[model samples]
Target: MNFVHNITAIFIFAPFLAFIILLFLSRKKLKRGAIGFSADITTFLLFLSVPVSVEALWGVNISFAVSVTAILMAMILLVLEWKKTKEIEILKYVRKTWRLYFLLLAAGYVIIWLTGLALTVISF
Candidate 1:
């Protein structure tokens, strides 16, 4: 049990490992081999960041913050798509949503890491 927990912790903290693993799986099996896999990786990284934010004293309701951001992004995209084509294609909407999520999460991950690092250093 402890071993499993340690492994999970490693993945949570070092998400590059997850990205590499995803790259391999996508190339070897899925054969898509594009940047599509990054969306999943960043999503995991962002959601996992809630705990890190709490530890860094920057978040009391980090989960809610993340959720609301994602919802707002989707709504904005949905509105723009509707205006452009007078329709919302579900597949395209879904794809754009996740890709946008990937960018947002990646940015948030960097900011959160920097904030946490700064706070920790200042405390010491």
Candidate 2:
């Protein structure tokens, strides 16, 4: 029983741990691009955890709507920012951290899938 509790606790707190790390990095004033991208990813993970959490607690399968919505909102904001900045160098920010972005993207999807699987398993 304690092991089960521990696993659930880890699942619930993983995103929060990442969030705390992000906060610490922010205090150190790291590059905005890196922090911003990480924040987006952390947010996506946090959102992803919700439906899984619900399923874990209430035996109801739910879609990862939150993650999709967050992605859409991010796209909208990016477009808006590009319009506001009106700079052709918009892609430069992405280029600076392309590898990091790719890694984060992969990690985000992995987290979503893993969490969903864990939730389904635990719910039974």
TM-score, one value per model: 0.78, 0.40
lDDT for each residue of candidate 2 in 52-112, tens digit (9 for 90 to 100): 6556656765555545654565566567657878763656645434434334544654666
Best by lDDT: 1
User: Per-residue alpha-carbon lDDT of model 1 for 27-70, expressed as tens digits?
Assistant: 76667743577556656775776556565566466777778878
Q: Give the TM-score of candidate 2.
A: 0.40
lDDT for position 12 in model 2: 51
> What is the C-alpha RMSD, rounded to one decimal, of candidate 1?
2.5
